[model samples]
Target: MPGLDIREIVRAANDRWNAAFNSGDAAAVAALYTSDGTVLPPDHAVVKGTAAIADFWAGFISAGVKDHDIELLDAQDGGDMAYSSGKWWATGLGEDGKALRFEGTIVTIFRRQPDGSWKTCLHTWN
Candidate 1:
């Protein structure tokens, strides 16, 4: 089979990731990963498993997290793998109108599946 384009794949991955986070549904975000995926958030222990990863996002969603923006900085593909690094920022407003801001970079690794779809195998955020 012909190889996937690194740039297009990376763009789609970033878009899907942004959508998942903006949705504020932990399950939705976690669904972007493979079944045995792992995620490392800055200063936090690694989160593994689909269920556990989904649960991890629950807190932010429950707190009404919203408005996430992701900007892709670089991407590369080699063999059966692809990776992308990007910066993201999000804002949240509480019922009392208190504002909160979060900014970070997402570095993700994707593995090509037999079905030709790329799924996240590892993710780390800063």
Candidate 2:
């Protein structure tokens, strides 16, 4: 097959991710990953597998994170695998009810599923 339009695919996936996160649905956010997906969160031990990934997101969602934004910078298809680089930012409320914010660069790998949809295989941001 010809090269996949990874830019479009990632754009749509990012939209879904932002929506899921903003809605505080950690399960929905984790559904964007592959079964064996891994997350390398800043300053934290690596989280492996979908369940752990869901738990990681659940913590953030429960912390009242919102307004998540992802800006895709680059993407390339490599047959069954692909990679994307981007920047992201989000806002949340701290335990003290003060506003908290975060922004960082991100790199993610995606694997094409049997159903022809893309899911995150590895994700890292800082």
Candidate 3:
């Protein structure tokens, strides 16, 4: 097979994740990660493993989060490993029905799977 385009792969993954998150499908969002993926969210302890990742996202979804957007800044392929850095933003309704918003920069490491798909191995954001 030809060499993979890291930017395209990561962009597609981000699109998929945004769709899943907007739809409130935490499991689908977690499926974009590797089996033993790790996530480090701002002001939270590290979450490891697919199950833990799914649960973490489930909490956000249940809290009425929506309208996620990911803007890819850079992505590079390094054999079986790749990395991408970007900015993300989202908006949702707060408990009092006011608009709540969040935006941050994210850096994620991805691993190429045997099936030629890229999955996030480490995701950290501030």
Candidate 4:
């Protein structure tokens, strides 16, 4: 791990997120966040804490969203915090039950856990 970089770290974190999300396990997705983690979803009210975040993700999963992906354009770490910014997208069911795509720029902040792993602290996208 001596040569591992911030980009690699962010990618690994996001990979775990995608795995949890794709599997339709909201609890697993929430586990990727810090205990007080929060999500600022587009055009929606802010969601905080692991439980609320789990329900938030459950809403999305129930709405038929899948194939969520992240493309880390930039990543940096300092002290006990790190952040990544880039493209994110997913497909979901529209009102007509047809495939609808959502894509946008996003930034995610993560905190270093006591065990040296990173957990999401904040996320916002537009």
Highest lDDT: give the candidate number. Answer: 4
Candidate 3: tens digits of C-alpha lDDT, residues 4-77? 47798899889998999999999998999999999999899999998999999999988877899999999998
Misplaced by over 4 Å in model 1 are 1-4, 93-97
Candidate 1 vs candidate 4: which has greater lDDT?
Answer: 4
What is the TM-score ranking, best to worst? 4, 3, 2, 1
After superposing candidate 4 on the true structure, give the runs of residues whose Cα lies further than 4 Å from its correct spot.
none
What would the per-residue lDDT of candidate 4 be over residues 1-126, giving only the tens digit for each residue?
Answer: 247787898999999999999999999999999999999998899999999999999999998999999998999988689999999999998888888999999999999898888899999999
Q: Give lDDT per model, in order.
A: 0.83, 0.92, 0.91, 0.93
Ranking by lDDT: 4, 2, 3, 1
Between which residue pairs do clashes occur in model 1?
none
Clash count, one per candidate:
0, 0, 0, 0
When 1 and 2 are scored with TM-score, the better candidate is 2
lDDT (10s digit) by residue, model 1, range 6-123: 8788788778877888877778888888999998887788899899889887777777777877788998887689898898888877678899787888888998888888889998
Q: What is the TM-score of each candidate against the true structure?
A: 0.87, 0.93, 0.93, 0.96
In candidate 2, list every pair of residues with a backbone clash: none
lDDT for model 1, please. 0.83
Question: Would you give me the overall lDDT of model 4?
Answer: 0.93
Candidate 3 residues lying further than 4 Å off, grouped into runs, are 1-4
